[model samples]
Target: MSHSGILTLLTDFGLSDPYVGVMKGIIAQVNRSLTVIDLTHHIPPQNIHLARFALMTAIPYFPARTVHVAVVDPGVGSDRRPVAVALGSDPNAPMGFLVGPDNGLFSGVLSQYPALEAVELTESQYWWTATPSSTFHGRDIFAPVGAHLASGVPLQKLGTTIAVDSLVMLHSLTPQRTKHTLTGCIQAVDHFGNLVTNIPASEVNGQTWYAVVKDVTVLGRKTYSDSAPGELLAFVGSHSWVEIAVNQGNAQSVLNLGIGDAVQVILNQPHSSQGD
Candidate 1:
């Protein structure tokens, strides 16, 4: 089911602006036959942590060889390197291309797919222009480069090879597990205001769990129905993380939470103290 010659774009640039459209236009100009999928255009501006989590969750569903262009760059005009990463090309691995700035926006997906090959986009010829706008690398660099990659241009030819370890990775909050408590940080806030924690859902599988955020102890539930309407509850989200949500309500508003907010998850009884 791998869709070749397909490119997926994710950006903090909302639909109101022409930025996302312009990037698509550049991609189309480079390769008219390629299919461009708009993964999303509504990522909160400058929210790299949320961008990372979104990419991580969505990439597993895309077919192999789809190029992913993510632009949540806060350092667009700075000296940050523009990068294109080829990941998970092995037999049973998830294969895709990640195109964006060298910031940690790609880190979440990289944790799962480990880089097969990565390059700094130094070849100006592949970009839309020789003198790209310092502020908008999305249109000038990432768009065209991703289009070229999806159009079958080789990865190495795009730019200089760099060590996978050298790539910038965010020191995002990793969940710490004790016998009965998991301490982590919120990594994303969904449209419904459900707070997604860095803690993996598997940790509390088949066990009772509750979450404490902003000093409120939320009851654990198997689903939203476990709580009354507008009541905040915690549950394992369908993806990979634990989510704190209020049934038919905005948890973000109730908790006054945002990304990086501290989260304490209390689970019942003993599990092996692996991450302690």
Candidate 2:
């Protein structure tokens, strides 16, 4: 908190390895005063889509001027370009910064924030040490670049500006909707066993509905304990998305639901509080 700005780290590298430590070491060496927060280090190796989703969920919670450095690159030694991105309305706006490969990891972030500005991390000399390992640029290249940016160096110094359309974006998962039914798939399962679905709350027209996951139908509730303390229920999450959870237990374990599982929301029937 002592630093002028925030620098957050997100990576597919698990915490057991020295990779996260090495990246932090490089950043600390450059700007000791900068505050560094670890958004996540266990992102399921090489899962760029998962990384993208995690970044989208975590970045908005941080204050403005937070630099987010994400490294879920599976194409480290390949032709993929190392890049830095900023998301905000104005090109000169001081907001979020993303450092990673030009893979589809930026997809979710770009979708959420349309006014995105990006640039390739082109200055090799600005990178740490004399020679950077092609495989570990997270420590050698990205960390140093992030540290410099967190220290107030202009983003234009990172590289030449580019069009937002030029950046790579993955195809987003689509939510299917009918007259009174909305179908979506489980996008992710967090450590807590909460099934995060692709369905956002905005898509639900009614206050109550039936959340059918797999073959089990859980009555939609407004809160975790809308049923009983240990009962399974559905609720609109803080992210404004519907999630199936147990009040005092793990829904993923109790119901055996995982990522990519199908979920359906059936709207309430006339004169009935719950959907059939």
Each prediction's number of clashing residue pairs: 0, 0
What's the lDDT for all of these models? 0.88, 0.81
Q: Taking the tens digit of each residue's C-alpha lDDT, what string does model 2 give over 122-162?
A: 87767896577979989888999999988887777888888
Worst 10 residues of 1 by lDDT: 267-276
Whole-model alpha-carbon lDDT for candidate 1? 0.88
Residue 175 of model 2, lDDT score: 82
Q: List the residue pairs that clash in candidate 2.
A: none
Assess candidate 2 and give its TM-score to the true structure: 0.88
- Tell me the lDDT of model 1 at 77: 90
Which segments of candidate 1 are over 4 A away from where they belong?
A: 1-3, 89-94, 269-276
Question: Pick by TM-score: which candidate is best?
Answer: 1
Clashes of 2: 0
lDDT of 1 at 242: 87
**Each model's TM-score, in the order given?**
0.93, 0.88
